[model samples]
Target: MKRIIIASVAAAALVGGGTAFAVASDGTDSARSSSTAFQATAARASLSDAAHAALKAVPGTLDSIERDHGRWEADVLGQDGTWHEVTLDANAKVIDQRVDRDTDAEDAAEAKALRNADVSATEAARKASSGTVTSVEFDDDRTPVWEVETVTNHKERDLTVDAHSGKVTQAPADDDHGDDDSGDDD
Candidate 1:
């Protein structure tokens, strides 16, 4: 029943017929380019040693990562079990850092949930798609799944994997994000 809910959510989030990707036949540039872009992002992600270095600078457990506004952004769980949003430049220099928006209670819950995840972020990204992992998170599900984001072929993608079962599902792109390239290097 839970898997059913998960599948339903994914089908609604990704595409018709409970599929993980949009078929080329869909003919929407947004749809087709997303996959292509993902490939591009994935292709390029592995080359960013700076993002990795920025991640290592964080003083705790790592959470999720993603590229936004032309920079590699990450969420790290500190040794105190708090989440921090960190950004790194192309040279891997830390350009910004701050505490995550979640409340301390939320942080505690996420930290506790992190221990049960059998799949690491790198493994989860590889299983979801061929790219560099940008971010990872423990979903708010009762069972707690891993929500991982990756960049490949100059595209972005989201994948959800069961923390214990290793079940993976690719999500559809929702670009309605009100974010902008304020931090992007122009």
Candidate 2:
């Protein structure tokens, strides 16, 4: 399933705008359905139109982009594999660009952490509360844990899965800044 999803994402890498999204089963006993639902939303979202617009103010291709609360945070993977963080305003204009950072070491750390992970993000979502996966990201550092977001009880809640132990725990109030949220421009 992981390989299939990866292949799907790879095949859809260069896609833009809103795409189809797969929603997981709802872990409730209400009239809500408990099956995968196809919705219109980008799957990979390596970059968004706004992110690309903001990219005009930066240099590099999009590695990953996620909503940081109210703003869009993007990782611009440089041609040389270096990583830079680009923050976009509500209008999709570049508001801040972080300094260039080495992705080699960070990549290695994340790979190692994931290598030891027993629960995949999908499995973590199952262990969470049968909620649909909204997003999955690391701790923004060398942490092997994965932060999984799922919509349950008609709201989005975050769960942390230990990369090494596969333990699931409720994450904080979606407020943690690391390499992705690093830097403050003058």
Candidate 3:
């Protein structure tokens, strides 16, 4: 009798453990499949004309369109000669726009400024170290600012320069460090 009871209990434990394992595995697989299906469905929807028209006003070809946080983000080029990051609604209507101006404008402004309190590109770059002029634009106050991306001492940095004074208005250390050196290390 004792032997029979022990055998029954062992068998029951084995069956229960197997059942639990199967359930957990099946749940994970189903969740992944469903998420993939949803993404595929969303991708099939075409962009609306309103979105295209808004982007057309900006310069450069459309680089990419992505669905982000219930909004569509379109990256376009602007006449000012820099990339513009635009956000649109799901229906393809413009929600917000951020203009990135060319660096040349800052250089030219800095040079002119130095000649006569006029800002020029050389002076702006010199003040902020070396980086490609990405964009130059005026804020609401009409203060011209230059945005630059550069590498110094092997570290990448970004700077916002006052176009008139050729002074750094803001400087932010880049978090994306050692990216280019990664592949070489391996």
Specify the highest-TM-score model's number: 1
Runs in model 2 deviating more than 4 A are 1-102, 140-143, 175-186
lDDT string for model 3 (1-186, tens) is 544554555445443322111111233535543331111112212333434645666644443344444456665544444667787664566778886555466544533332343443334545765542222323212454555444555465667667566678555554555678555555
Q: Where in model 3 is the C-alpha error above 4 Å?
A: 1-45, 48-51, 101-186
The candidate scoring highest on lDDT is 1
Q: What's the residue-level lDDT of 110 in candidate 1? A: 71
Q: Over the stretch 53-77, how does candidate 1's per-residue lDDT look in tens digits? A: 6557776655666655445677777
Candidate 3: residue 97 Cα off by (Å): 0.5
Question: How would you encode candidate 2's per-residue C-alpha lDDT over 38-133 as one tens digit per residue?
Answer: 543333332235556645666544444555543567665544545678777545667788755555776755545544566554355446554645
Q: Which of the two, 1 or 2, has more lDDT?
A: 1
Number of colliding residue pairs in each model? 22, 0, 16
Model 1 clashes, total count: 22
